[model samples]
Target: MNVINKLKETAVSVFPVMVIVLLLGLTVVPLDKYLLIRFVFGGILLILGLTIFLVGIDLGIQPMGERCGAELTRKRSLSLLLICAFVIGFIVTAAEPDIQVFGSQVRGLFSFVNKNVFTFVIAAGVGIFITIGLLRTVLNISIKWVLFILYAILFGVMIFCPQSFIGIAFDSGGATTGPMTVPFIMALGLGVSSVRSDDENSFGLTGICSIGPIMAVLLYSLYLKSQGNFDSSSVVQISETAEAVAAGSPLSQIFGPFEEISGEVLRDSVISIMPLFGLFILFQAFLLKMTARQVAKIVIGFIYSFIGLTVFLIGVHGGFSQVGSELGFALGSKALSNGGIWFVLLIAVGLVFGAVIVCAEPAVWVLSEQVESVSGGTITRKLLLVFLAIGTAIAICLALIRSVAGFDLKWILIPGYGLSMLLMIFCPSMFSGIAFDSGGVASGPLTSTFVLSFTLGAACVGANGNDSFGVIALVAMMPLIAIQIMGIMFKLKQKKGGQK
Candidate 1:
C-alpha cells in the first residue's frame, strides 16, 4: 500500500513535465527520435527513483533528524548542541544531490573555481547558519528581527561583492535546502522546538537556516573577487554527444549516459552520505544509545536512501538535462529569429513551465505538508501549492524578460527583497518564517536541474551565462512575496472570524 501510494504521488508530480515536454516536441521543438526515447525512459526512471527516495526520507532521514534533534536539546548542553548542529548541517548539505549537481554546473561554466572547495564553502555556510538558527530557537529570538538584520547585512555586503557572483550566491541558498536537507532540517527544527512551550518557534528554524548559504557564498565571492584570480568569460556550449559503438546494442544506446553519470554519482553519494551516517552512529553510541531494533530500522532506512538517491540522480542526469537544454535552445533561438509572436509564445511557455515544475519538486511537497500540519489545516496544501505555482510563474516571466532585455539582476533583486522585508514587518510572525523558508523550498532540485538549464539556454541566445544564473534566485525570491501575501490574507480572515 505504501509503495502504491508513493508511485501515485510520483506520477502526479512528474505528469506536468511529461505533458509540457510532449506539447513542445509536437509543436515548437521537434526533438530527435533518439533523444525523445531517452527522455521518456528517463522520465520513467525519475518517477520510480523519486518514489523510492521519498519513501526512504520518510522512513530514515526524517526520523534520524527528529530523534537527534530531540536528544540534543534534552542534553541541555549549549556547546554540544551547537557542535552537533554545525556538524549535521555541514554534512547533510555537502551530501545534498541538488548542491552536487549545481556545483558541477558552476564548475563547467567557470573551471577556475575548484569544485570541492566551492562545495565545501557552501556547506560551511549552511553549517554556521544552522548553528545560529539553533541558538535563535534556544534563545527565543524573533525570526522577523533575525531575518531583517541578516538581509540588511546581506544587501550591505552585496555592494562590495562582484556583480557576476551575486546571482550564484543567492541560488546557492535555494539549492542547499533540497531533498536531502529539507526533511532532515525541518524535522530537526520540529524536534528542537518540541522542547519549547510555544508552537511558533517550531516553524522558523528552517527559515533561518536557509539564509546561511547566501551570506556565506557572498562573503566568499568577495574574497575571490579581491584575489583577482577568476574568469569572467561566458561560453555557450550544449551537451556532448556519445561516441557511436559498432556493437549496436539497443540497451547500450539507451543506457550510455546512465553508465557514465552513475559511476560519478555513486562515488560522490558514498563520500557525501557516509560521514553523516558515521556521525549518527557515533551519536547513537555516545548520546542516543537506542535499542537494537531502533538502530536496525535507521540503518535500513539509510540503505533505502542511498539506493533511491542513486537512481534519482541517474534519471535526472541521463534523461532531463540534455532534453531541457535542447528544448531551451530551440525555443530561445526561435524567439530570437521571430521576435513578436515567438517572444510572446516563449513567455507563455515559461510561465506554464514554471507553474508545472514546482509541483514536481519533492521538497516542495515536504514543505507544503509541513505547513499544512503546522497550521492545523487552516492553510491547505492545495492553497499553498497554488500560491507557489503563481509565484514561480511570475518569477519565470521576470527571468525571461531579463534574459531578453539583458538587465542587471540587481534591478529585480534589490526591489524584490526590499518588498519581501517590508512584508515581513506586516505579516504574522509564523508566516514570516514560513514565507522565507518557502523561497528556499520552492527552488529545489527540479528548478536547479531543468528550469535552470532552460533559462541558461534562453540566456545563451543573446546574453552571458551570468544572466541566467539569477533566474533560480528570482524563482527563490518571488515565493517570499506570494506566501507573505497569503499570510496577510490569513491574518485578515482570522480577525474577521474573531468578530463573529
Candidate 2:
C-alpha cells in the first residue's frame, strides 16, 4: 500500500482536531516557552500516534472484522444468527477505541464507577441491539415505527435513571457506534442480505444499531440509581472563578497495564486485549471453523493493529485528549472572549471537520461508493460527499453553539430525531436506510474522540457550562437531519429524473 496515502489519510483525520486545539490555545494559553513546547511536542506525538492507528486499522482490525462478519453470516437459523450477531457486536464493540476513550473520560467524574464494566456492558448492549437491528433490516421493517416505540420505551426507562447518568447513558450511544463498528456492521448487513430474499432489507442497519446503546445505558442507569443522588457534587467540580486551572496530560497520567506500579500497565494491557483475543479464539474455533493457518495470519495482523493502537491510545490519552480538555476549558474560562471569535471558530472548524470527514473516513467513503455503484451511479459519490460535508458542517456548528449557549442537548436531539423519523415516512426506501446509517457514519472515529472533547472542553470550561454532555448526541443527531433532508431533496430530483 502507499505509505504516503496512508499518512495523508491519518493526517486528515487528525488535522481538524489539531486545528481546534491550536485555535483554542491562541485564544487562551500564553505564548510562553513552556506552553509553546508543550503544544508542539503534543501535536507531533498526536499525529504520529494517529498514523500508527490508521495503519493498524487498515492492516489488521478491518480484515479480522470482515472475516468475523462473513463467518457469522454462514449460519442460517434466526436464533443462531441472533446469537452470532450478539457475540460479534459485543466483542467488536468491546475492542472499539472510541468507546474506551469516553469511558476513561467519565472516570474523571465518577470515581467508583468502573470504566471496564461500562465498556463491556455497552459493547454487549450494542451487540444485542445489532442482532435485533440485523433482523429488522432483513425482515424489511418500517424504521420509524420501530424507533418510535423503542425510544418511547427508552425515555420511560430514563425517567427512573439517575439524572447524572442520564447524560452519560445518552452520550454512550454515540460513542460506541463508530468507525470500527460501521464497516463491519454494514458488512454483516450485506452478508445477511446476500443470503436473504430481498434487496431493500439489507440497508438501514445503522438506524437500529445507533439507538441500542441509548436504551442500554438508560436501563443500566437504573442499577446506578439506588447508589443515591445521581449528581454528587463531591465526585465532580465546576468552576467559573479565575484560577490557574491545569490537569496533567493523559499519557503521563496513566502508563498502561504496568506504567507506575508493579507493572500495572502490563496487567491493563492484557485486560484491554483479552476480550478481543478471546473472541478471536471463539470465532476461529466454534464460529469460523477455519484452519489454524488462516486464524494465525489474522492473529498476526491483529498484533500490528494492537501495537499501533497501543501507541495511538497512549498518545491520545496522554497527549491530544489533555490538549483538547485544556484548550476548551481555557477558552471557556475567558469571559472577555468575543462572540465573533466563537462564531468564526465554529464556522472554520466546522468546515475543516466536514472536509476531513469526507476524505479520511474510509468506512464512510467505502459505504458511499457501494451505494453509488449499486444504484448504477444514480447516486454519485460527489453528491453523497457534498451533502455529507454540508451536514457535518451544520452539525459542528450546532455542537459549538451548545458549548457557547449551554443549550440542553435534548432540545437539539429531540427535534432533530423527530424530524429524521418524520422523513422516514416520505423519503425513498433506499435513501431512508442510507440517511439513517449516515448519522452514525458521519460521527465516526475522528469526531467521537476529538471533536466531542473539544466541545465538552469549551462548553464546560470556556463557557463555564455544566450541561455539555450531549455534544455526541448532537453530533449523531445533526447528520440525521442533514442526510434525511438531503434524502428528501434527492427524492424530489428522482421524481423529476434530473441528470440521471
Candidate 3:
C-alpha cells in the first residue's frame, strides 16, 4: 500500500514533464546521443526515489510530528513546549537538503561566496522563523501583523544589502520551505493542533508553517550583502546549468570535493534527528503508554523518513541541481534573441511550468485536498487544481516579464503582498489562513527546479544578475496575491449570506 501510494504520487508528479518531452519528440531536438537516455533514466530514478521517499515519510516523519505535537501538549508547560519548538525548528531546518541545494547553486553563480556559509545562514534563518511560527500559534496572533513586520524588516535590509543579495535572499526564503520542511512543519502543526479547542486553530498549522522560510531567506539576504562579493555579478552563461552542473555521474559527483563535507551534513542531520526520535519514544513510553504496536509503527516510520531524506538529498546534490542551472541558462539564452521569440518562448515555457507544477509540486495535491475538505465540497479538487493552474500561469507570466523586461521584482511583490494583506483585513480568517499558506506551498520543487530555472535563464539574458535572482521569489510571492483575492471573494460570499 505504501509503495503503491508513492508510485501514484510519482506518476502524478512526473507525468506532465514526460508528456511534454514526448510532445517535444526526441527527433526534433539537437543534443547529445545520450540525451534521451539521460532524461528517461533520470526520470525513472526520480520516480522510484520520490516514491520511496513518500512511503518513508508516511511510515516515519508524520508519526514523529504527531507524537511530538501531542507530547508537547501533554507536557502542558508553555516554556518547555516553546523550547521544543525552537529546537525542533532549528534541527529540522538544519537537516533540510533543499537549503544545501540552494547554497550549492548560489555559490556556483558567484565566485566570492562560500557554499557552507550560505547553507548555514539559510538554515539559521529557518530556525529563527520556526521559533516565530511557534510563538504565533501559541499567542493566536493574526497572520497579517507578523507578515507585515517580517516584510518591513526585509525591505529595510534590502536597502542596506547589496542589490544582488536582495533577490537571492527572497529566493532563499522560497527554497527553505520546500518538500523537506513543509511535511515536517505541517505535521508538527497537525500535532500542535490536535489539542486545540477550535477547528480554525488546529487546521491552519500548514498555513502558518509556510512563512518561516521566506522570512529566514530575507534575513540571510542581509548577510550576503554585508560580506562576500555583493558588487560582483555572475556571468549569464549561454545556458544556466540546472542548480548544479553535474560534471559527471552521481558517484563521481557526490564523492568529489564534497566527500569530506557530505559526512558532516549526514552526521549533523542524524544528531539532530535523534533527539526528536528519542523524545517521541520517551513520550510514548511514559505518558501515552502506547501498546507495542503504535511504538513499532512510529519507529518504522522514523527509519523510513531518515532513509528517504538521505536518498532525496543524494539525488538533489548529485545531478538535479546542475541540470537546473544548465537548462535555465539554455532557455534564457534562446528566449532573449528577439522580442517576438521571447514572448512566444515565455508563454510556452510558462504553460509547461504551470502544467508541471500542478502535478509535480508535493504540496499542490495536499493543498488541493485541503481546499476540498475545508470548503466542504464548494472547492472540489478539480476546481482548485484548475484555478491554481490559471493563477500560477499568470504569476509565471509576470515573473517572465520581470525577467525579460528587467522590471524590479519589488514592484510586483510589494503591491501583490499589499493586496493580499488588505484582503486579510476583510476576508474570513480561514481564507486568510489558506491564502498565507498557499504562498509557501505553490512554489515547491517544480518551481524551484524548472520554472525557477526558466525564469533565471531568461532574466540572466534579459536583465542584470541581481534581477535574475528574484524570479523564483516572485513566483513564490504572486500566489499569495492570487489566493487571497479568492479569499476576499469567499469572505464576501459569507457576508452576503449573513453567516457568522
Best by lDDT: 1
Where does model 2 exceed 4 Å of error?
1-4, 12-71, 95-101, 104-120, 159-163, 197-199, 223-228, 231-235, 239-277, 287-297, 334-385, 461-464, 498-500
Order of candidate numbers by TM-score, starting with the best: 1, 3, 2
lDDT of 2: 0.63
Give one digit per residue, the lDDT tens place, for model 2 in 1-500. 46577566567656665565565566545432334344455445555654554555555555555566555555656777788788878876777766766788677677766888878878878887888787775566776666667767776776676666766777787777654467567766766665554556656776678778778777666776666535556366544322232446654433321133224323444555566667667767777676678666667756655555455444444444445555555554453266666556554664565555444454565567557755778888767777777777777677766677664555776677678778778777777777767767776555665566656666665443665466666666666666677778877877788766
Model 3 segments more than 4 A misplaced: 1-6, 25-29, 109-117, 203-229, 232-289, 306-331, 366-380, 465-468, 492-500
- Write candidate 1's Cα lDDT for 1-500 as tens digits: 28798788779878778888877887778876566677788888888887877777777777788788888999999899999899889988888767877788777766667788889999999999899888988898998899899889999999998787788898888888877778788888877887775567777676677778888888888787777755545433434322323244677767777887889978866865687688778888898888899888888877877787778767877878777777776787888888888888878888988998887777787778777887788889889998899999999989987876688889999999999999988899888878877888888777777787777777668555344577888998999999999999989998999999
What TM-score does candidate 1 reach? 0.93
Screening candidate 1 with a backbone cut-off below 3 angstroms (N, C-alpha, C), the clashing residue pairs are: none
What TM-score would each prediction reach against the true structure? 0.93, 0.78, 0.80
Taking every candidate in turn, the Cα RMSD to the unseen true structure, in Å, is 2.7, 4.9, 4.8
